[model samples]
Target chain A: MALLEARAELDVIVWPEDRACERSWLMENVVGATGVIVMFPEKVNTELLDKAGPSLKVVSTVSVGYEHIDLKAAAQHNLKVGYTPDVLTDAVADLSVMLALMAGRNGGIGVDLVQKGQWPNFSWSPFALCGPQLSTTAASQTRKIGFLGFGRIAQATLARLVPFGITHCLYSSNPSSPPNYARDAALAKQHNLRAVSKVDIDELARESDVLFVLAPGGSGTYHVVNEAVLKKMKRTSILVNASRGTLVDSDALAKALREGWIWGAGLDVVEGEPNVTIDHPLVKEPRCVILPHIGSATLETRGEMTTRAAQNVIAAILGEEMPSQVDLSTVL
Target chain B: MALLEARAELDVIVWPEDRACERSWLMENVVGATGVIVMFPEKVNTELLDKAGPSLKVVSTVSVGYEHIDLKAAAQHNLKVGYTPDVLTDAVADLSVMLALMAGRNGGIGVDLVQKGQWPNFSWSPFALCGPQLSTTAASQTRKIGFLGFGRIAQATLARLVPFGITHCLYSSNPSSPPNYARDAALAKQHNLRAVSKVDIDELARESDVLFVLAPGGSGTYHVVNEAVLKKMKRTSILVNASRGTLVDSDALAKALREGWIWGAGLDVVEGEPNVTIDHPLVKEPRCVILPHIGSATLETRGEMTTRAAQNVIAAILGEEMPSQVDLSTVL
Candidate 1:
């Protein structure tokens, strides 16, 4: 909505309805398009690339996660791929925090009570609906945040979390770029935190108060948060994932939530997600908050993403440097 | 729940199923009740006071608004009264901010699309679902904010809004107290905002980008936000109410929403609220976000309130001075 509203004057844009459907008119329109804007669900693979022809300059997508789009295909066609990333971290991270708060505070029951008109003018007694509170008070002693992946959006998301009483952060990444330890330490120190990189997922899961998954998608880290990792977490710990649908095992997470393996879970993504149902193991649970993949849905973020994507496509066609290009080697 | 858990040793507590129930019972172990806790709905008038039978020196209730309690009756019986106040301001203020954000960003539609499965992945189009963005940069100007009543909670809410890029603030109070122009100006200056009290309800309604209702409940201020106020606001303006359900005229607000008289309304409180339904006019409207009176529903806030209420009762009975005493004279 933000992108459309922001760039309404565009002469031409390429958008396909679904992955499998490619109408001749849609392909023809793309061939004549001076600019192109695609989304996460729509695959811009070789067929679409061939359809796009030579006029295509930019390929703007409204997603932080670019798993659906083929960067290799775009690179072959000398097409620029534009993706929306850093802009969405705040909105997504804020929602993540909201989810954690809701899960810990019995948000489902509260919303139900209101809908049922069971709210009393004043409640009596203790621990009636007491869940958890997040704060950086001395009483909390040690607090550390864990992220499954370290990237630009994850870093920005961590920055927001720091002001809200997090004392340290532990992250597990693929140890690329020689582990830039000094820069990482400086970043953590800037936020009065100790930034540590864990070699093992168990250490990261067990030691951290809250675990956030911002790791990349696919088999490399698929189901990284399996039963063992969940079991290793402190009883009062929380798990948050705003990255991708395949990172955590939904069944294991459901069991963990039902059996109190962990205190609560806040997932913006889940296994077999967005075909998400009320019957989905995590969906029906009160302790889990399920969003319909709105990580980059904020107006500011989406608009910026669309504009950048458009610019990338334009730069690629004009043979200029693409603003944001994914590593083709990582493609499936 | 916090209070009840805190005093787990004290088992017996009065609980009415609803507002009209008057059934009372005495448990076998009633001899050990060191304190009594009651709210306005329980009718702490003479009969219940006499029935309490002198063993109770302290009575505390969990609320900042204490219109239901009779202070004179408490004083006559030599019973100490305690109520929760300042502790809940932040929670209510946070809800106020949430309401404002939800309304401005078209959250109602967002929820509906996700619920109905109308939203497709990474969707973008010309004018799809654009709404106001809170962040401000050098190129973007801050939005204007106004308050219908400026109290401690309102001040706290204003502080939260500051980070969301609010440039100015205006408030309109009752016909009395003659508007503390200098004080309001000083407060606005403190926050680097252009705070003005010169505006009447009409001017505020017309000029404010966002208008907040932070007044008290009941007859004198009933439906203070009528059709007149709604008519004055900009076509893109939003209204937020977290104070009392009786402050806004639901029919007028509903009609305004239906007519798009204003952009949207975020209501934590509704007139004759909690009785709201999907069939309700406002609920049927596209731009209205009606929350079920969750102004101070956060677990942290509710727990602290319960604890404070208990502490208030304990202190007053022990003759150590009630920590939170209601200003009974303020009640209408």
Candidate 2:
């Protein structure tokens, strides 16, 4: 609204305030629209693009993931695409570390016990409600953190973990991208870590005290943390997924948690989220802490993302370069 | 058991293992006991000292807080008091930071919404489920952290917050203790914080984005964060109490939450904990994230504490300097 109000020269129409814009309404209203800003709920497919006609100069998404956008079709139609990235890295990374702490400390169980009025009956034993400590203690000297995708958010999470006395890091990035030993070495030195090395998915699963799934969501990365990988993880290890839910197999994770293959899981996103109910497999597990896809839901971050998305649309419409234009070639 | 088994010369009698030893059982078993190891539930008062006759040389508690013990009675009885401190610092500190993050990010509300199966109906908007971000963002350039007590756990908690881009710190230590400006300067420089200074309680409440109550629990500090202080706090701020329950007034805090005096609160310890029921005012608040007094509840920390308590008892019985002995003069 701020962006639209700032541009007095342009006329704007908003989807009549609802949780999400109706498809039929959007299709009809977008007929001769010059620019469109959408959230994750709106599917920016070829159909929507076709209805918008050639006048649509830009499609800006207020999210880092562009999976909902038909990038190839947009490119063919000569429409520039922009996504809100980099801005949400800190917010998402904060949630990632919070989830790690929550999962490792039996956060869900503790809260449930309290909320259910069971605490009075819950006697305090020496190790009652005890879970793995997030910070490294003298008894447990070494701590290793693993990242499924060592991207911007993962690296930010690593920086936060340094003070927790984490000694080592292992991450799996795009297998095709050549490993940067120089950058890894410098990061290790900078953070005073024993090692920060790239490794195979199996090694990452087996070795990490806490495994973080921060990879992109796509067919290539789907179900990367499946039953086999979960089986390889330590019984005391924790799994945290702040990335897209599809990157982890929900059923497999539930089984692993039930069988004590992994200690706990903290998920901000589930395979089918917003649709997740109390009867969901993961939700039934006592140790599993699940939040409803709120990884980048912070006032500060959301404000920035909205501004960025608006800026992209305004820029593209004015025949100027989009501030965060997506590379169509990579999407294709 | 390990300690008793290791020492063949000492005669040890074990309590009939229950959640907590019954007072009758403890009284009978303590008769002529040379040393005793107790948890928080077992009070080490003058009556217990009398029941033990003159044989009691030590009363070692496997806990950091010794408020359950009658310190003056122990001092007069010529009994050495030992407590498990420092060992659980990391665990408690970890929880302190976790609580802060949880409070700031609306963790409790989100979990409840999902657990209660309301998430499916909960539609996502640009600002839906948005709470204050724990990490400082470009728009919000500064974050100020406050500490009610600048003790070991508080310092450790501060260390964890350094990476979150907290710019300034305000701590109100024991007013009787002379201010250490030099140490504050060094700490500020070490963490690259803009400032680290001791301030009055009012200033601490007014300035802090998140105020941590880590002070000792006693008459002097009881209800330190009462209605007036709560009123002075920022509406966007958070209050986290990982210390003893007595330091915070539960009703006042609940009112604060109800009336939106502050954004939210994360409490590990309530005024009447272990007994905090569903009807409890704070528990009834949507934003209040209450844990079951599990601040130091970690396997590693508990194990270390148990070992340390045993060692203290063994050492005291042998007429050697007990490790981590409590200064009885301070108690008096």
Candidate 3:
């Protein structure tokens, strides 16, 4: 607010409510605007750009994911785009680990059982309500963690898993990328992990006691974790999707969970999320824990993202370089 | 099953079902029995000992907690008792961290809201569901983890927190126990923690960003985390109880949560548990995530505990030292 207040001549309009702005209101108000800031829900498409006409110099979003924003449209209009990326890495990574733990430990089931007043009827059995342990102990000598995509959030999550006696780290990323033995060796030594190496999807599924899907969302990566991929995962393994939901087939995962192909799942993003109902296949599964796209919902991270988005708009309007500008050429 | 099969020469009665053994049947069938192995629910008191008569040589429980066993009565009856320990440490410790993360990140509320079909009604606001991040991210540099007791489970939990960039560790144990600076310093150095020191209850309450109660259950520690301590804690702090439910006063905690004295709590055990209902004070709080007592409810841990318990029974019956004999003098 102070930054905007400094320029008294500038006019600003914000959505009146805490909710995402209505599409019609945004299109109407965006006209004659020099800059606009939005979030995941507000689509920056050709229609919005055309509505803004030539006055809109930039569109900055308070989110890391830009699949909602049509970069091809922005490119056609020769518009600069800014996104908050690394600022929310820690928050998303933390939520990733939280999901992993929740899935592995059956946290959702535990809470639900208690909430329904069924706890009093449950008996203390030797193996009842049991799930996989996330840490290495006397019974388990080694713990292995796998990532579908070895990106910033995945690595951050790996860093958090080191002290849990994680012995191996397996990741399946872009196979075309060259192997870097030196980097892998350094990471292994730093975390005292026995090995840190890239693996194929099959091996990643077979070995990971907990597999985290942290890949980007796109048609190319859609359903990367389908029935075939899930079948290879250890029956004791847990699957966590803290990234885009499209990377995993919800129907396949729900079937896998029901048939005991995989032990459980924790998902932040679902295929048709924000519209997921109580009867959703994944939500109906006893072992699957679902959250409504809250991977970056932390006070500190959200505030930082908002600040960064505002800064990007202010910079773009003044013809200054954005701190975290999205390269349209690559995105397009 | 194989282990017990080998000892078929000895008369043994097995519970026919996977569920808890019928109480009336146990009391009647235990007559003239040389040994008995039970779990948390069975009370090994004066009545049980009297019923077993002089034939009962040992009573073994498939749990680390012996609060249900009356050691004084067992001593009078000249019966050796065994309790499983160490086997479930890793499982409980893992759950402790899981609870802490769930409480800090609002996992329970997030899942519940999604399951209730409320997400579509909710808006995507910057700070709608924001809570504290468990890991030391760009927004948070130092994470302080506190423990009510510095015993095995607490230390195991501390080990897990190290990878999450925990900077400080504070614990409060029996005041009579002398501080072991050398051991604490070594732990600090090993985990790259800034400091690891024992503190008073007041300091623990005031300083911890996440407070875990891993102390043993009994009258001495009952309600240790009362209203005063809750008031001293930071509003953003999280409280986790993986030990015993009695450690926290449920009514006080309910009021604290309702009035926003602290952020939230994750409880695996509750006072008068197995009796917790939907209208229970703690369960009624949205911020409090309650689980039926399931700290050691892992397949590996529970199986190990049962095997250990059986071994104790077999050894005691064979005129050999028990594998995990409880020192009656100390316990009494």
Candidate 4:
């Protein structure tokens, strides 16, 4: 509600327009709205049947996830549903790379050294404060890149990692419509990547020098990278999680990083986030890089997302084809 | 001696194979040395004469400053004296730009916020933790870049800063030199910079939004940017010192930064380093960025310096031109 008020261009009355205001408040606020916008938070159930009045037209969301909105409600309303997607892929991927670089070189540890004034008196050796350089060396030979869910952002991230000397790629994903093997094969052909899917997660852990998690976060993918899978990872392997926090078991991860099961973890999300505390166990490790969920916060990308979201609502209300609409049947 | 023992190359031999044992242990260790590298502590007068003997051929110091070496000694011995000169200009200039950027935006302070886990819990506002960006907008647009001693490195630093929307540059040099107006003109022509040598140091302080102390350090240049100059500088202006620590009074600088005489200071050198403690007054300021004496420490640059020093010794022994000989006339 606050976001809409701030972005008043959105003028659409829906079941959720004045969810708590009053009986006709939705109609009052969006008197002639041609489009309706929503997110995972708003429940668009049967209650929408009574409130969606004739003025209601289209639906859009600020989120990529559309789990809460009722597609049935949207269909009954005969309204197009719009959602912002793909806009965040590059920005999120850039953050993942930043996290990986910071973690691998112990840059996160330098934070303490900078502020504490210990730099001058600190006894340093060529080997001291030295961490692995991302460039493939004679010893490491080749950096094998892998992804748990190779979606839009994951592919972009892989492209960026290539210049840093990646040798092979492996990935896994849930089977999509008519089977997505053809699509996966086409993409691999395009990027010259080896596209292997839905392999035993253990293979991903063992063969990968860097693993990126790009799958949607939910119950089905909960704790996908658990103790057994983590144990299978190479001791020098790095795990980069930018998608969501729930897919990883934080306690198990802390233990693994502590006991040297893997080289490091770079995370932009943590379960029950925005509440990440200093005492968070992962923060204690020299190899973990925890960003405050700024994956899609680049100036250009965020600005574009905002403008696109606004335009989607405006266009849908004007009774035009939505720029983008969620196809949730694929997910269900 | 310590450096020579660490590096035993087929460069130069300053003593007889039989007299190698009689030579000063320090000189003896730097055997097969092509260039007799000397820094501040190793006096290159008669002491070097007795030590270097006939094997002592080319004298190369690893620093831009070579006042400690004796020119007459080299001339008398028919020895070439080499010093590292222009190799680090770009690297040092790059660091100056980084320091300016970091100080202007208060990047170093964020290290504490992110590492201490104080983010996300409290939402930072539009103006919160915000310092002025390098490029100012229409409402408030004013920025002036200045230098204390505009030499080669200063010129390089100025070139790097031009992209940041700088409109003017004011610098001072040794009053004794017949005003380096030609170089200033060349810089102006190349960078389209409004380069000028101000007669009064206070004039530069009043006009500049950032002051770079690129002057040499010693009795001749000591306390050049003193309280008087700092007082005249804009309150929002910053000071960066990569040249020498003695150019600015450390205590006065600490006070200036603390009391807001100027925005901040970025220092890579201190008056008494290694001996300087965590409790040093300058280190107490959160705005100050004090790097160890690593201006020429980049792997690429250091390797070049070491290799060049070896070449100097090798060439001098072979009666070839020393690649970079120090103008000892300046030291006297």
Q: Which numbered prediction scores highest in TM-score against the true structure?
A: 2
- What overall lDDT, based on C-alpha atoms, would model 3 receive against the true structure? 0.89
CAPRI class of candidate 3: medium
Ten contiguous residues with the weakest lDDT in model 2 chain B? B12-21
DockQ list for all candidates: 0.19, 0.79, 0.72, 0.10
Q: After superposition, how far is residue A147 of candidate 3 from its true place, in Å?
A: 0.8
In terms of TM-score, which candidate is stronger, 1 or 3? 3
Worst 10 residues of 4 chain B by lDDT: B14-23
Residue-level lDDT tens digits of model 2 in A1-332: 88877999878998767587788999999999999999998999999999999889999999999988888899888889999989999999999888999998878888888999998998878888888888999898999999999999999999999999999999999999999999999999999999999999999999999999999998899999999999999999999999999999999999999999999999999987779988999989988999988889998999999999999999988889888999887655
DockQ of 1: 0.19
Question: Docking quality tier of candidate 4?
Answer: incorrect
Candidate 1 residue lDDT tens string, A11-121: 544343423234465566777565566666567778877887876766677677777777778777765567766656656655555555545544444544443445543
lDDT of 4 by residue, B1-332 (tens): 33344445553333333211333665556544435655444556866565656766677776676656777777776667877777666556655665665465454554355557875554522123444444332333455788989788888778655544466778877877777678667767765555555556878888887888888777898888778888888777888888887888888888898999887777767776645666889878888867655555443444455566655655666678778876556443
Candidate 3 TM-score on chain B: 0.98
Q: Across residues A95-125, which tens digit of lDDT does each residue of candidate 3 receive?
A: 8888887887888999999999999888777
Interface root mean square deviation per prediction: 5.3, 1.3, 1.4, 8.9
- Report the Cα RMSD per candidate: 5.3, 1.3, 1.5, 10.0
Error of 2 at B142 (Å): 0.2
Task: Please give the distance, in angstroms, between residue B301's alpha carbon in candidate 3 and its true position after superposition.
Answer: 0.9
The CA root-mean-square deviation of candidate 3, after full C-alpha superposition on the true structure, stands at 1.5
Model 4 lDDT, residue B311, Cα: 59
Output the lDDT of residue B83, model 3: 91
